[model samples]
Every structure is written in C-alpha cells, then in structure tokens.
Target: MFVRNILSAIIISVAPVSSVLAAGGDTPPIPSQDWSFSGPFGTYDKAALQRGYKIYREVCASCHSMKRVRFRNLEALGYNEDQIKAIAAEYSVEDGPNEDGDMFERAALPSDAFISPFPNDNAAKAANGGAFPPDLSLMTKARANGSNYVHALMTGYKDKLPHGVELSDGQYWNTYFTGNKIAMAPPLMDESISYEDGTIETLDQYAKDISHFLTWAADPYMEERKRTGFKVILFLLIFAGVMYGVKRRIWSNIH
Candidate 1:
C-alpha cells in the first residue's frame, strides 16, 4: 500500500509535465536575450526602464495591472518627483469615504498603487471574453525563465494557423505560449509606439523593453542586493586572510 501511494504521488507530479510536453511539442524554445541586469554585478539600464514604463502605461496598462508597483517607485527609472506626480494624476483610484460615508474616486497620488483597468476580476474577465488579464507586477518572477518567456510571448503571434489547429473565439495562436494558444490577442505591432529618443519602434524592441521593465519591477532591489553581497564577501576574505596570518605568526613563534 505504501509503495502504491508513492507511485500515485510520482504519477501525479509527472503527469502535468508530460501533458505540457505533449501539448507544447511544436513550440520553439524561448530564446534568451542579453539583459543589462543579468549578472551578479549587473545593474538596470535606466533608459530601457523608462521606455518600458512608457510601453506599460500606454499599451499593456489597458489590460494588465501592476498592482504591486507604486507611482513613487518610478524614481528608480530616473523620474523626478514632479514627473511622477504628473503621471500619477493621469489615473484615478478609489479613495476613502468623506464625512458623508461614501467611497469616492480621486486622482491617483504617487503613494497609491497602480490602479486596475477593471474594478474587479469578474469585470475584467467580462470585458475580455471571459479571460482575466493577469497583474504584471510579479510576472517575471512567477514564471520559469520569465523574462525570456514574456519576450517570446509578446513576439510569437502567427496569422497563419498550423494544420489541424483551430483557435476559439477569443483565443490567438502564438508559437511560444503553451499549447500554442493564448487568450490575449497580439498586443503589439511595428511602429505602435513612437519614441521621442528615436528608439526603434519594432515589435521585437517593444517586447524586449517591456520584458526588461517587468524584470526590474519584480526585483527593484537586485542591484543593491548584489552590492551588499560583494561587500560581505570582500569582508569575509579580508578577515580570513588576517586570521591566517595571525595563526602563521603564532605557530612560527611556538616552533
């Protein structure tokens, strides 16, 4: 009985992976892109983050929410207090009741979290044909190889369907999404957004920018963490060298 129970647990775990492999057999591997913030010493590209924020605000914000991010967090992307306030004011958020005891809506403040496009999940799903757009705050952290996954997903749409494949009404075909089917339609196109700094406005560039931005959003403290780690390692090495020298001198005198 115990052996059977172990077998059942193993089967349950392996079943999902096997099913995924079967469903995604035709899907190409997600390609890794060179990111400015990839290595232990790597830091975020501030320009990319700003561009990414622009994309998020203008494009993805219509469907997805960055609930974990606050407007003041734009400081990391080099936005000044005034710019952040202006950006925040463009959106409205639900605020506390007045003396009348009624909830009210007001201009968003820098301290407020990013407002959802929909008031709730059901409303979001209703708007998107029964598909709930996910909050993107922790998206890069939630998925395996999330940055690459997001980039691939954003650029993987196909207008032509493979043989024997058909999409349901709201579904679209993507080469990188699991089962080659995704609820969200292709959300980007060439020249969809114009960059004042003259960055290329291609789909691939848009994907890369948004992926970089989401990665930063998921781990804003990555550079600080890396710096602290380097400092700790350097201190440990110096302490170890000092201790070794002290041991050698003490042993030399004893001998």
Candidate 2:
C-alpha cells in the first residue's frame, strides 16, 4: 500500500511537468538577460531606464499604452519637474465635464497617466487590423520571465519565413513569440533613433533598454522592498542570537 501511494505521488508530480512541456512544446526557450535589477540587491539602472523610456516614446508608443505610469513618475528616471512637465505637455489628453458636461481635450499634466494613442478599443482595433495592442504598464509582471521574454520578442524577428510556416497579411514571424507568428512588424532597427547619451543605437540595445525600463515600471518599489527585507532579516538574526543567549543563561542556572 505504501509503495502504491509513493508511486501515485511520483506520477502526480511528473504529470504536471509533462503537461507543461506538452503545452509549450512549440515555443522556444527565451534567452536570459543580465539585468542590473535582477538579484536580491539589484537596483534599476537609471541610464538604461531613461533610454528605454525614449525607445518606448519614439517607437512603441504608437500602439502600446502604459496607462498605469504617470508622467510624474519620470522623476525616478532622473527627470526634474520642469522636464517632466515639458514631456507631459507634448501629449494631449481628454479631460472633464465643463458646465456643458462635455469632455474637453487639453495638454497632459505631470499627474496624468500616459494616455492611449486611440480613443477606444474599437478604434484601436480598426487601426491595427482588428487586433488590439495590449497595455504595457504591467507587461513585465504579466508574463513569465518577463524581462527576458520582452527582450527576446523584440529581437526575435526574422526576415525569412521558416519551412511549412506562412504568415497572413499584417502578421510577421517572430522566433520567440508563441506559435511563431506576431501581428506587429519589426519595431526596432539599427540607428533608427539617436541617443543623447551616446549609447550605440542597435536593435539589441533597444530591446535590452526597453526590457529594463518595463521591468522597473512593473515594480518601481523593488529596491525599497529589498531594503526592508534585509532590515527585517538582520533584526530577526539579532533577536535570535539574543534569545539563544537568554536560553543559555536560564538553562545554565537550572543545571
């Protein structure tokens, strides 16, 4: 009976692994990246985050909306109040009901979240061949190995189609995307945008920078969380040591 129970447990554990492998058999492994904000002590690289923001602004902003992030949050990327305001003012956003109870368009403020490029979902789909682009605010947290997946998807476009694979109109081949077909065309190219900071402008670099930025967006308080965790661990260790000494004193007296 014990042997049968042990076999059943082993089979249960192995079944999930088999199902996972079967479900993702067609998907290629996402290559890992060495992000600055990866480990327990990891912190976001401000320069990379700024560059990533620029890439998103110039390239990805046409389709993707990062509605969870406000223009004021650019302060974390080292932007001052004036710079943030200037950035915010570049975009027009919809604002409230006047005395006439009608919505009005106005220049965006620092407090305003990044606005969607399209007014509504139907409009977005109409613009993109009936495919709605996903919002990017929490993309890093929404996917498994989110940073690596983002980097892979960005750089994984292929010019030539694989044998036995054909793409429909408005679809492109991506080596890393599931089922190997994606709606979005290649978004990044070498030297597409010049950098103020003199970083080389390449597709791979763009992917990395954007991945880093998105990760930071997904978890802006990672550094604070890690710091707090370290403090808690240190306090626990000290308390444990003190308790051990007190127990030793009590036992010593008893003995």
Candidate 3:
C-alpha cells in the first residue's frame, strides 16, 4: 500500500509537467519527406534542381538573396555558358570607377553574385514592416530539419487561426513557422508559374523544388564528396583484403 501511494504521488507530480511541456511548446513538428538527394549514394535530381532555380528566380529572389551563389553556379543546374550569360544579362549590377571615380550600373556578369532586392538590412527591414528577409544562401544548413522546414513553411499558410491565438498586425499565421506566426504572407498559389518541363505547378511542387534547390545551394559538392568517400572505402577494403592474404602467406610456414 505504501509503494502504491508513492507511485501515485510520482505520477501526479509528473503529469502537470508533461502537460505544461506539451502545451508550452510552440513549434509544430515538421513531417519528413523523401528527397532524391537524401541518403548515401544519393544524387540530386537535375530536372528538379532546374525547376527549383526557376521558382527561386521568379518567387523567392525578390525577397531573399543568394549572395553566396554566382550566376556561373547555374551551370550546376545544367545551364550552358551561353544561357548563363544571357540570364546574367537580364540584371544590372553596380560596378565602379571607369577613369571617373563614380560607381556605375552595368549588366550583371556571369561571375557576379545574385543581386539583392533591398540595398541593405535596414532598408530590407523597413520595407518588410521591420522584419528582415534572410539571405537564403546557407538557409538549408541554418535550420534544423532544414529542407522539411522550408517545405512546410512554404505550404503551411492557413486562412483561419487556431482558437485563443491573436496575431499582431503585419503578422501572418503559418502552421509550421515557429510560434505559428510569420511575417511573410503566402508567396505561392496554384499554377503560380508555368513549368517548361511539364511538371505540375502546385504549391507543394513549388515548395519541393525550391527546397531541393536550397539543399544543393547549401551543399553543392555533396555528390562529389559522397563519390570520393565511396571510392576511398572501396580502395581500403581491397587493400585490407590484400594485406590479409600477404599475412596468411607469410605465416603459413610458421604455423
């Protein structure tokens, strides 16, 4: 009877703590999805990467800058040099001092980093109602479960808020965002952009493509690294086998 009372007391003590933890946690769990680049020996889907780049260019680029990625980096998505040059020519970049010490604007070069929509952080915040749009260059690595979070955030907008939750002005509800309130509004819609490769243009599709692209941006050499690792492992296995054979031959007479 004493042991039963003690166990009941422990359960009573733990119940409120568990309830508090469950209720107080704000960030919703993100569901994992299969990706072409997910596992060992996995590689990126080229077509998805291309479509992702197109989506980023049309949608996310307006707010988020990929400062680490150069126009030339598009070659990794299967764009030829001429196509990259043409794409770079579409934007104007600031360049400097042609005998006159003044900065001048010229067409963006293949080597130029992606142009930012806002000139500076303060300007970006001012334009975005005091919310700074983060650069997406390393965003996939910046967040835990990064790809899943990106995909969830892109598709998590809801028309109605949950009960007892009040959002301040300029804040939007996102089911997957931390605290369930995000500053950015829904950025995608059904058939928002046409795909030349005949892929469906749903919001989920857009989210997946952009997530894949961001993953590649975070680790462009992931495939190369995996390939090199595999080769090293194979070489080590073969060398180990040869060493074992030589050891057996050397000790055969002694035993």
Candidate 4:
C-alpha cells in the first residue's frame, strides 16, 4: 500500500513537470497564407535585391554557404560581367593538386562555383553545434511560402522571453523555421547594413525581394513559363469562344 502511494505521488509530480515542460516549448504562431508576406508570385524588385545582396554579403555569408550559385549568375539579375567577375574574385575557392602534389586553394574565377564556407558537412555541423545553416539555393521551395518565412524568421527574435520559456544566449526562435527554433543567431539588425539608396526600414520590402530572388533561383525560366502559359490560356479561351458562337449560329438555323 505504501509503494502504491509513492508511485501515485511520483506520477502526479511527473505529469505536471511534463506539462510545464511542454507549455513553454510552444512556437510562436506563424502567419497564414492570406497575410501580406505569404505570396511568392511577384515581380523582382531591383532596389530590394541590391539591398539583400548587401545583407547577404555583409551578414549571412560568413557562416552560410551558397556554393551552387556562381558570381556570374548574378549577371542575370542585371549585373555586368565585369562586376560579376570582380565579385567572384573576392572569394578564395577550394582547389588543389599543383605539380608538387599538394592541395592548395586559389581565388575563385568568374566561371567557378561559389565556395562552401565550411570544408565539409562534418566541419559545418561541428562548428555550428550540429545545426548546419541551410543553403539558400532552393530555400524557396524548401519552406512554405518561403520568401515571407525568411523575412519573418529574420525579424522574429524577441528580447523578452515568452512565459515559461527561456532563450539561450546567441540562440533565437524564428516563427517560421520548422520547429520554430533555430541555431542561427538572428542575422538582421535595423540599419545593421546600411543602404546608400535610402530604402524603407520595414521588413515587407526586404522580404519581398529576397523571396523573389529565391523564386527565380528555384526556376530561372519561371517568368517566361508564366508568360507563355498566359498567352496559351488566352488563345484557348478565344478559340473556345469562337467555337461556341459558331455552334450557336448553326443551332439558330435548326431552331
């Protein structure tokens, strides 16, 4: 009887502990698709992309990697070849095997791919404490309504701890990261990277361009594809309308 009573007490104690543990762990609510930042179907904003590139270069590039994208590819975004080459030359890429049979790194060429920040997967994980910052290449498709999600995640970290919760130093909670928590320390700070061209401080514009860039990254052909589709759809509707009128004219004779 004493043992049964002890077990019941233990269960009671553990239950509340578990409940308390669960309560504070809840993530901040994510905005719905109806929200302003939810859609990816938008035109690329040049000024915002320029600002985002500045952010990427000054802030996020230190730890994260975008090895898939070549500096030259930025030319598609309207950068000149000389500008692209100059940018590519800024980074030293991993390379090796000289006549002496030793591995040596060389400056990245315009034609070469961007270098991964970490040497390899193990190194990346070890450095980041087992959380590798995700590549931005396909991040648009990787997350739901990815553009706004990126923006929200950037601006979402809070100074005030939510009830029953604690945030670790240098760790942040993002409303959009899967599981609502992330190892990446909040990367953006207002005026953290200044724009010479005086853009608004609001997150909406920043989020919009980054998402647009990622959308283009996911499918470079998207604009052409969408344009072609619209043309085809319009043509088909016109054809259908013409056929319906012809049918109506034939039916009038019968009537």
Q: Identify the leading candidate in terms of lDDT.
A: 1
Flag regions of model 3 displaced more than 4 Å: 1-25
Checking candidate 3 for backbone clashes, the offending pairs are none
Model 4: per-residue Cα lDDT over 1-255, one tens digit each: 999999999999899868855766544455533322223444455565666677677767777777677777786677888888888888886677888988888878888966677878788888887888777877777877566566667767776665655666556766555555678877776555666887775555555555566656665566566678779999999999999999999899784
Kindly list the per-residue Cα lDDT of model 1 for residues 1-255, writing each as its tens digit. 999999999999999888866665467779999998988899999989988998998999999989999999999999999999999999887777889998998999999999888888999999999988999999999988999999999999999977667788999999988778889989889999888888999999999999999999999999999999999999999999999999998899774
| Every model's TM-score | 0.89, 0.88, 0.93, 0.76
**In candidate 1, how many Å is residue 39 off?**
0.8
Full-model lDDT, candidate 1: 0.91
Candidates sorted on TM-score, descending: 3, 1, 2, 4
- Which residue segments of model 2 deviate by more than 4 Å? 1-25
- Write the residue-wise lDDT of candidate 2 on 1-255 in tens digits: 999999999999999888855554266789998988878899999999999999999889999999899999999999999999999999998788988999999999999999888888888889999888899999999999999999999999988876656678999889888777788989998888789998999989999999999999999999999999999999999999999999998899674
**Which ten residues in a row are the worst by lDDT in model 2?**
19-28
What ranges in model 1 sit over 4 Å off? 1-26
Q: How far is candidate 2 from the true structure (C-alpha RMSD, Å)?
A: 5.2
- 134-170 in candidate 3: lDDT tens per residue? 9999998999999988999999988887766778988
- Evaluated at residue 64, the lDDT of candidate 2 is 92
Candidate 4 residue spans exceeding 4 A from truth:
1-22, 32-41, 96-104, 168-170, 201-209, 245-255
Give the better candidate number (1 or 2) by lDDT.
Answer: 1
Error of 1 at 128 (Å): 0.7
Better of 1 and 2 by TM-score: 1
